[model samples]
Target chain A: MSFINYSAKEINCKIVYYGPGLCGKTTNLQFIYKKTRPEAKGKMVTLATETERTLFFDFLPIALGDIKGFKVRFHLYTVPGQIFYDASRKLILKGVDGIIFVADSQVDRMDANMESFDNMKLNLDEQGYNLDNIPYVIQYNKRDLPNVVPVAELNKVLNVNGVPEFEAAAFDGTGVFETLKSVVKLVLIELKKGA
Target chain B: MPQSPFVMYDEEFKELTLIIEKLLREANSKCVYLVDKDGQLMSAVGETKDIDATSLASLTAGNIAATGGLAKVIGEKEFSILFHEGERDNIHISVVGQRVILVVIFDKRSSLGLVRLRVKKASEDLTKSIEKLLSRMQAGAAQENILKEITDDDIERLFH
Candidate 1:
């Protein structure tokens, strides 16, 4: 739910980053945190396991430029990508206005990506959000890695719905903002329809 | 303009916050706080300083809102208790009368069941106060006599 603060005249929306473990879910957020203008982004906190895998979640409040007269603030969150953290992931998906599905582009990690996508769908269904219609985007990350799945093959399996697909090297900051922009824009459009 | 912000509640409702405080203490829990559906902190108790109550309040409400949405999807109304287990401890977040969020954080020392019971009572209490507050807010009485309530120094301090 977006809050329309009459006092501040700003609209705040929550956007979540979700995907399989090590699919660069946290990296996508980290990249944004690093690249955003210091004035535009709030503090970013990432709590991970001993191996540095995301444990609970990473939260970053990013203020995108004002669209029309309303200040657009997106609270970005990333759930732990590990499979055992399914419960935690479901909890994090709560009240999400938009989503970016980061699919690991590794050829060997195809199964994890598929399982995570399934988990995402199941969780969304339980939360009354339908990916088929909700504001969503997709990114095939690790494009720079060798033995990475070709875009077409990845799309054949992952892009069944054909949401905006991006080839991202999230660590180097490739296609990160494009993915973010597309999702935010789609969410704004959805909000506009309601208005 | 009530005696106590919580005094408007009858005796049963009046004991709500105390009950939550006592329960947390007994369970050796870290902290407990009540937040509105929009994540505004209504009241807090225990060691919540290190914890970002603002974010916690917002996220807890978000958790509640999502559970409510899930309820609608499956032909249910809304979940009363949502117990999420962390690696060491756990977070017990629930909706109270569909108006407020009651959150309790505890480690292995505290049980989820106890937290749930106390929150149930607190929810009843909070709902009444919240409803009354909302009606009062809508009446626009809160906006009246604004200039008389504060001194010039207070206004000046706001600028500095």
Candidate 2:
């Protein structure tokens, strides 16, 4: 759920980046954190295991300028992509305003991507949110990898809803902002409709 | 989707800050803050310069949600309280009114027992305050559109 504090003149929304293990979900967040100006971003917190794998989630709060007179802040989070972390994944999606499914485009990781996508749908359903209605975008990440699957094939499996999709090499920051902007725009549109 | 949008007015914010401040003093805690279950910082009090309130709020909410999931797997209704003991500081989180969380961070000056005691009483008051706030918002929601202040043009400019 979005928190709109009239007294504070702030609009806070949560967005989650989800995909399979090693799908560069956290890299997308790191890219955003690095590119964001210090004045516009808060401390980036990563709750991860000793191995650097996300144990719980990675959270970054960013100020996306202003809308009207209110400061629009977006809290970006990435769920632990490992299959064993399903419980943690569900928790992070508790009040998500928008989602970015960072699908691994590598030919070998296709199954992992599909499994994670299904899990996302199931978790959203359990939380009483239908993926069809929520504002979301897809990022076929790892595009620079030589073994990557074709965009057409990835889209056939993951983009059934035909939501906005982008090809990204998150580590290099390619398509990162494009994917972020697309999802944020969709979220703002949703907020306008709700208003 | 399960809950309505969390909206806090000036009066309610004042009341909440006061309560948190009192709790901080009474518990001898370094800081006390209120965070929505959705991870938004509502109100905070005490020394927080060394603390990153925004990040803490989000992580605390994640911690609570994870614990709640654990509670479900164990066949429990909910785990209302969570405590994390560190080498120096400790954090005590409790669910208030089922929507917001009251977190108290303390150092060696206080004990968990004392923090919990203060939190128990503070949670009750906070719960009532939040309930009142929500009811007032609901009552006036029909008459006033909080989003009315935001226009289509304003939103359009955001993307550009």
Candidate 3:
């Protein structure tokens, strides 16, 4: 859900990065955090386990300038992509404004990617958010890996709705901003449409 | 969107901030703030400069959500209140109107019992105010055209 605070002259929205474990969801956020100017970003909070895996979620709030004088702030969150964390994933999606599915592009991780995609749908359904209607984008992440699957094949399997998709090597920051910008654009358009 | 629309106009914002200020004073807490379940900090009052309100808001929401999930699996509807005791400071969190959270941060100046008592009363007041605000937003009285002034060009320029 987007919160429009006229008093503060700010528009706040939540965007979740959903994918399987090791899909670079957190890396995408880390890159954005590093690139954003100090005045434009807040403290990036990561709730991770002892092994550095995300335990709950990663949160980063960035100010995307202003739209018609209202400060447009997007809160970026990445749910713990481990399978057993389904409950945590569902909770994160409670009021999501947009989603970026960061699919690990390694060829051998096909099953893990597909499983996470299906799980995302189920969790969205449980939260009464239809995957088709929500503003969504896909990032085929880790594209620099040697054994990555072809983008066409990943799209054929995961992009059933044909949402805007990008190929990214998040660690190197390739296509990271592109993916974030695309999703943010889509979200703003949706808000303009009053959806 | 399954979640109801959220908008805070001047009147509603004033009422909510007033409530927080009163809660902070009554509870003798260092600060009082409100965050939506999504982790967006709505309003805050009292001595907040020493605290990272944004990080606190995000972490608190995540904590509450995790606890709420635990509540569901245990066959409980929801866990209404959560308290954390720190070395010098403590936090008291309560779910308000099922949409927003009321959080109070205190120190040696206040007791847990006093904070809880004041929070209970403040929660009731906040619930009513938030419900009214929600209804107004739903009715399209105050939030009908929040983005009416925003243009495609304005949105496009952000990326450039």
Candidate 4:
């Protein structure tokens, strides 16, 4: 859920990056954290295992400038994509305003992608959120890999809602900002419609 | 939107801040803050200059959510209070009105008993104030849509 603080003239929204393990969800956030101006970003917090796999989640709060004088900030979070962490994933989705489904585009990971996508829908449903109504976009990450599936095929399975989808190589920063911007725009537009 | 977005106005913000500030003083704590269940930092008081309030807020909520999940598995509705002790400092976290998390940070200058007592009183007042604010938001929902006044061009301006 978004938090609108009139006292601070700020609007804070939560956006989660979700996918199967090793889909570059954390990499997307790290790239954004590294590139954002110091003044515009907060410390990136990663709750990860000793080997650096996300244990609970990764959080990065970034200010996306002002809209009609109210400073707009987006708190980007990535859930632990490993399947056994479904409980943790549900907790992270408790009050999400938007979502970015980071799908690994590898041909061999198709089943993993489908399974994660279904898991996301189930989690959101349990929390009273319907995937169709929420503001969300899909990111086909790891596009640099040679064994990746075609965007058209990935969309056929993951983008049933026909939400905006981006082909991204998050480690190299390709389409990272574009994906973020698209989702943010969709979130704002949804907010306006709600208002 | 199954759940309404959380909104804070100037009046309620001031009231909440005052209550937190009073709790900070009464508990002899180093910091006190309120975070929504979603991890948005609502208001904070005390030695926050060196602290990363945003990260703290996010983690605190995560802690509560994880605990709450555990509660459900064991067939409990929720765990209303959580406390953590460190070598030099401690944290006392409680849920207020089932929506907000009240956090108190302290050190040797304070005792958990005192912090808990003060937090008990403060939580009551905070819960009442939060109920009022939620109602106000519902009433004001029809007043004006801020984003409606903004144009697509205005949104495009943010990126540039």
**DockQ top scorer:** 4
Better of 2 and 3 by DockQ: 3
DockQ of each: 0.05, 0.64, 0.70, 0.76
Q: Candidate 4: where are CA atoms >4 Å away?
A: none
Looking only at chain A, give the TM-score of model 4 against the true structure.
0.99
Q: Candidate 1, what DockQ? A: 0.05
Show model 2 residue runs off by greater than 4 Å.
B1-3, B140-146
The sequence of per-residue lDDT tens digits that candidate 1 reaches over residues A1-195 is 554433344456677888988889888888899888888786776667888988878888877765444455787889898899777787777667789999999999999999999999999888777888778899999999999999999999988998899999999999998898888777666654444
- Cα TM-score per model: 0.65, 0.94, 0.97, 0.98
**DockQ-superior candidate, 3 or 4:** 4
Candidate 2 global lDDT: 0.90
Instruction: Give one digit per residue, the lDDT tens place, for model 4 in A30-63.
Output: 9999999999999999999999999999999999
Candidate 4: pairs in clash: A1-A95
True contacts kept of each: 0.00, 0.68, 0.71, 0.79
- Over A1-195, each residue of candidate 2 has an lDDT whose tens digit, in order, gives 889887788989889999999999999999999999899999999989999999999999999889767899999999999999998898899989999999999999999999999999999998999998899999999889899899999999999999999999999999999999889888877876666
The segments of candidate 3 whose C-alpha lies over 4 angstroms from its true place after superposition are B1-4, B142-144
Ranking by lDDT: 4, 3, 2, 1
List, residue by residue over B36-114, the lDDT tens digit for candidate 2.
Answer: 9999999888888888899889988888888888899999989999989999999999999998999999999999999
* RMSD of every prediction: 10.4, 1.8, 1.3, 1.1
Worst 10 residues of 1 chain B by lDDT: B1-10
Model 3, residue pairs in steric clash: A1-A95
